[model samples]
Target: MPNPLDPSLATLIERHTGPVKQLRPTEHGRGSDLTALAETEAGAVFVKAMRDRGRAGGRRDSLLREIAVAPHLGGLAPALLWGEADSGWVVGGWEAAEGRPVDLRPGSTDLPAVVDVVRRVGELPLPEVAEDWPEQRWDRFVAPGEEDLFAGRALLYTDWHPHNFLLGPAGCWLVDWSWPTRGAAFISPALLVVELVAAGHQPAAAQGLLADCPAWSGAPAAAVDAFAAAHALMCRSAADRRPQQPWLAAVADAAECWAAHRAEG
Candidate 1:
């Protein structure tokens, strides 16, 4: 079904971006009420909308966080153009990063750009954004009394799902800043390596790629192992919230395998 923009939101889109010549809704993803491509007088704009009520609050909060955090991201993310969050709806438009989802299969050409972008992004020092600390949130996954090491000054884009990236002539552009997690600089890339494993890379091969990330190289072995174990537990626990998710199950298993591999070192 073509995503039909709400009439109320269309007015706001035109007001913020000028007259909409046409709108073509993109395939709906895991969250958000609407995702569409609009041909506006201003040009192409990627639009996302949330109602700012009920379940919408989660997506709304996520988008708001993206708005807060995107400026610090340099060119690694799509540009947020305009937004409003009063009344019943929260909507924002972004400069469309025209590209395709990244392919992370072993030996894929996209890996280099992916690593480069990850390095640049991982190097971006965490500014004073009111983001949540990941360590506190992941505490439930840590073994009791184990040394706490998840905290750091690095600003992390915790969601590393394959669909969140776009690869074009400009390289990899990370999109969907739904969960702006703050933690150790190595943690984000570490999380992504688990995703790489899930996408069919051997744990060793995935770990090999992480060496390109400076923070990963600086990470303590024990701390990295602990994080892997903790991530496995977190993935398993989160799967409980979305019972019967096949993808979550696969990621949980992959995370466990990576954790086990790290423990072997």
Candidate 2:
């Protein structure tokens, strides 16, 4: 297939990875303009790029944030090899992850690895660059005077889609740090609970999966309740605005179910 990147970005990437033998596009998703696995003389590398224009302007910031945090990720995620911006495009190359998305549904063996990785992520030292990036995505939806329930200094992988957790021969790897945030330790596993519910697990069972994660196990009931409620509101609003995206609606339903479970408890 033809190169999916801008000419200038292709040239820059080529300089680092050598001639691109093939560029197989992956799920670029809504946050990226280009996402491909490139086979090159240097070996395989995953590339994510975005055009610095129109609505992509926010995406450009996300790319920059990912680059900043990549170095601090230790082995929890792929290592950033190279990143550049040229001719209206921003690009990043990382050591390609050889893995498949984890399954979060009930009875999946990947659940153990998922719990381990989420715990490790919470243990990662908060990078100085992210000290000011509080977890506020749920702020508007949070009940008034309850926003402090979400505050903390731990770095959070807020996007908890199962696709973000890749299970490979080596171990589980978390990818797509485009929206990393500093927040309460419980937030990451809590978000993962939402994903588990979306994957067909009952709200209680989903929360059970994370029982090994200290952040989840130790979280106060009031804090979890507040987060579940706020996240349900956020998901519902997103689903309403993007009616064509059925997955958003599914997640919204899951969030509501989880929130109700919390309320009942």
The TM-score leader among the candidates is 2
Worst 10 residues of 1 by lDDT: 130-139
* lDDT (Cα, 0-100) at 258 in candidate 1: 96
Clashes of 1: 0
Model 2 agreement with the true structure over 1-265: per-residue lDDT tens digits: 2566567878877978888989988874556888889998778999998887745437888998898899998799999999987778788999998889888888999989988998899789999999967878888887687999999988989887788888999899999999888989999999889999999999889888888888889999999999999999999999999999999999999999999999999
Going through the candidates in order, what is the number of backbone clashes in each? 0, 0
Report residue 185 deviation for candidate 1 (angstroms).
1.0
- RMSD value for candidate 1: 2.4
Clashing residue pairs in candidate 1 are none
Candidate 2: worst-modelled 10 consecutive residues by lDDT = 50-59
Over 1-265, each residue of candidate 1 has an lDDT whose tens digit, in order, gives 1236667777777778777887887874548877788887668999887777756436778878777777778878888887877556777888988778888899898888778878887888776784553546677777786536887778887778777888887768899887787777788888889989998999999989978689888888888888899889988888878877788888999999999898888
